[model samples]
Target: MEDVMSLEGPVLKVNGELVLIIPLSAGGDELMKCSRGISEVQGEFLKIVIPEWLAGMLGIEEGDLVCVHNTDGKFHISPSSPRRVH
Candidate 1:
């Protein structure tokens, strides 16, 4: 997984994997649950590629869904909006 760190501190330790953090934009202490398939798992790290438009943003308040898909024996990472909550 990719090393996720901020100047303040490292939120996650690098296990040779990558993780995406979507921070809520709303001015409240709220949390959203995202569910996506394991498209690719690399050395204890996962490569979750969302949509190009939602590539970089903050928060899960935008929606209540996330999708994870594997295509043709390959890990096709893409953005998904799930209907159910995990």
Candidate 2:
């Protein structure tokens, strides 16, 4: 697996599988490039897209909540339980 751009975002499904959408304004493009991730533009935001292989490693699936940590420009993602803390 390849290193991905890091940021806090959900593990959502784009087509049928899991994908990450990292909201990064600066340095995200370069990071995505270096990490071999796809770049998507959402109006004014630049998002990083990593496929399900990475998600599979983290035991992440679509519809699951996640919190991604940025460690040295790498994606350190962790999935949260279905129960939400209100």
Q: Which candidate is the best by lDDT?
A: 2
Candidate of highest TM-score: 2
Report the C-alpha lDDT of model 2 over 23-50, residue by residue, as the tens digit. Answer: 4564445445444445565665555555
Candidate 1 Cα deviation (angstroms), residue 53 = 8.9
- Give the residue spans of candidate 2 off by over 4 A: 1-8, 22-38, 82-86
Candidate 1 per-residue lDDT over residues 1-86, each given as its tens digit: 43222111112222433343323342001211222352243444333434434434422223334333222323322334423446
TM-score quality measure for candidate 2: 0.51
Model 2: ten consecutive residues of lowest lDDT: 27-36
